[model samples]
Target: MEETINLKELFQILRKRLLMILAVTFTAVLASAIVSFYFITPIYQSSTQILVNQKKADNSIVQYNEVQTNVQLVNTYSIIIKSPAILDQVKKQLNLDMSVQELTNKINVASEKDSQVFSVTVQDAKPELAKDIANTTAAVFKEEVAKIMSVDNVSILSIAEVAKEQSPIKPQPMLNIAIAFVVGLMVSVGLAFLLEYLDNTIKREQDIEKILELPVLGVVTKMEEKKAAAAAVTKVREQTIGS
Candidate 1:
């Protein structure tokens, strides 16, 4: 019985604030759509694959040792790929306006354990620029690897290709709209309860009767517009006649 009464109150509050909830939900969805589609800039990602292969040698033992050495160097090379030393050359070679530090931030390098392949990913507002950055960073790293590590173990496995239909990863419209809708709904519900709590106006007959501890005789319906106007006119005519 208590739970049912609380549920009824909840329903009443929702019913009373249905319009505000809908208004807030609609506004939030619209704002999310607008910002996601028109205002936010799209970011494009491009990735290049490089192979960290061991240098070929005549001796089997030397080859095995070299492979192990290359595998161990993978983690170090991953860091070097994103370092300012390599990225600075990439920037200079590409004639990019971004600083080495900024370029490093935009680039990501990763390699799997025991795998010979590593991936270099770069993200930018322009798709072509992203691709160019990825490819150039890989090329710069490959050329300078021997100088940095004194081992020709790094090789360009695959160049970064311009994606046929690159999609932006950021400003996901559906996700943003969904989150906004939920947040708006929550905020609307909170505001509705707050307003209902703050409202001290007696809106129900029961409330008035309860406060006064008296039974209501009958409900007086409000007069219709036409009837109200007719009554006013009649009263004015009677007053004029009396005067």
Candidate 2:
């Protein structure tokens, strides 16, 4: 036979297991809060911006073609900034004990659409280190690009500086706790429905009729012990008085 539950049954099941659901959700949020605040390490990010434009003399007006060429060159420069030739030098300059691939993983390069300005962002455990890496990477890329491409178009628009009050970019405790709470609520509600579905004991006349597919002839009413005893005593008194 097919079985289905309506919205009322679903609400009843959830209500019956409301305590369990609340407990699980609370535990999950607490665990997430603890891990996010105490166990996970915070990572800091720093970014530097560079402008890609051809170097022109003071009296020369910039040409349209040159501007377009510089815009296209930004893409190539973004790739070269993460290359081993550039990052290796950055690592050496910073005296960092990290490989080229590891350093590259910590760095990100992005440019705006149809724009000549690009940004280099670096992430590290130490705020100072992150700032240093961003600035050094930009400097090294600028110097190397001039030698490799025979063009001095890259100019540092802004160098990364360590923030006075540094805040980590990762390990957002509130967000983690919110996600955990949602997951826990879903799991608990699903478990409640599964448990309800697995229960097969007859609890009412409707249950027996539904499962057995037969008409219920009658239902035996259960009397309270005090009421039954009082009725028996009254009947015995009547019989004694009649005798």
Candidate 3:
């Protein structure tokens, strides 16, 4: 019974503040949509893939050990691809205005473990620039790795290309609004309970009972002036009869 009553009270509190919660949630979603669509800058992404393979020393077919070695080198190659030697050349070839560190920050290299193929992804404000950066970085890395590693095993599998209709990869307004909706609902519900907890003024019979730990005896109703005069006379008459 106590658990049911507590649940009822909680439901009542939430119901009383439902409008406030909805309003807050709506406001939060609207703000997120506006920021996502207008305030945040869109970023476009492009990627190029490169393959690593060792050349056969003789006419005989390549061994599995050599293939494994090439796969292991992918980790080192991923690092070297982001190094200054590769990025500096990439910057020079592209005539980019950014520094090597800035260019490095924009590039991402990823490959599955034991995979001979790796990818270089680039993000920029412009789709063309992203495509150019991805392609140029791969070309420079392929050329420099041969000299640095003393081998010609790196080969370009694919180059980044701009599509006829390109789209940005970031600043998704729908996703932002969805996140805001959940966050706003949680915050608003918590705020409602907090406000309810802090309110101490007694406004109901149950509040009085809970505070006093006693039952209410009776309620004295207020009357108009004419009704008060009539009641006073009736009280006197009843007292006279009792006497």
Candidate 4:
């Protein structure tokens, strides 16, 4: 025989185990909150902006050629910004403990396609350190590029400023907590149903009869009310006789 579960039964099971599900969800959410607020450190970001332009000051020529030149040279600037020649000077000026490679890894250089403007960003746990790194790197990169290329094509448009607001990149509490809660709920509900199925031992008489391939002799109510009452009466009589 095939066995099938109905919606009503499912609803009943869920309702009965609702407390367990809620407990799991609350636990997951609380754990996320605790880790995010107390255990995780916040990260801060600082950025510097630079304008890239052709060495020639004359704008009479078609702007298209200048745009192409700027785009082609942007990759060179990005690499130069991370090179040891620039980063080593920055480290010396700032008296930083990190090596050139470490500083380079912290810096991010990006520019738009066919655009004359680009930005360099740095991130660190300390807000002021992030701002200082960005500004110093940009200034050093501008100076070094001018000295080497013998052209003043790169110029600092904006120096990085310390951010008033702090934002962390890691350990997103709300998102993590929500995911944990959902996963915990699914696991708890699955375990609940599994245990319930495994622990059920009482079998219907009809099922037993079918399995045995025999007819049932009779059905007994197994009532205990009469026997219980007679025992109570006999106890009362014994008490009265003793009195």
Q: What is the TM-score of each predicted model, taking all chains together?
A: 0.81, 0.87, 0.89, 0.73
The digit string of per-residue lDDT tens for model 4 on 1-243 reads: 133445666676778888887897788778888988789887778899988885565666657877788878888888888889999999999999998888888899998877778899998888899899999998888888989878888889999887466566666788888888888888878967876668556456775676787888887655599987898899999999999
Tell me how many clashing residue pairs each candidate has.
0, 0, 0, 0
Model 3, global lDDT? 0.92
What shift in Å separates residue 28 of candidate 4 from its native position after superposition?
A: 1.4
**Per-model root-mean-square deviation over C-alphas:** 4.0, 3.8, 4.2, 5.3
List residue ranges in candidate 2 displaced over 4 A. 1-5, 220-243
Best of the two (3, 4) by TM-score: 3
lDDT of 3 at 139: 84
The TM-score ranking, best first, is 3, 2, 1, 4
Better of 1 and 2 by TM-score: 2
Tens-digit lDDT track for model 2 on 1-243? 123557777888899999999998999999999999999999999999999998889999999998898889989998999999999899899999988999999999999988999999999999999999999999999999999999888899999998789899998888999999999999989888988899988888988888899999999887899999998999999999999
Candidate 3 residue runs with Cα over 4 Å from true position: 57-59, 220-243
The local lDDT score (0 to 100) that residue 211 gets in candidate 3 is: 99
Q: Model 1, 76-134: lDDT tens per residue?
A: 88988888888888888889997788888888888888877889999899989899999
Model 1, C-alpha of 72: deviation from truth (Å): 3.3
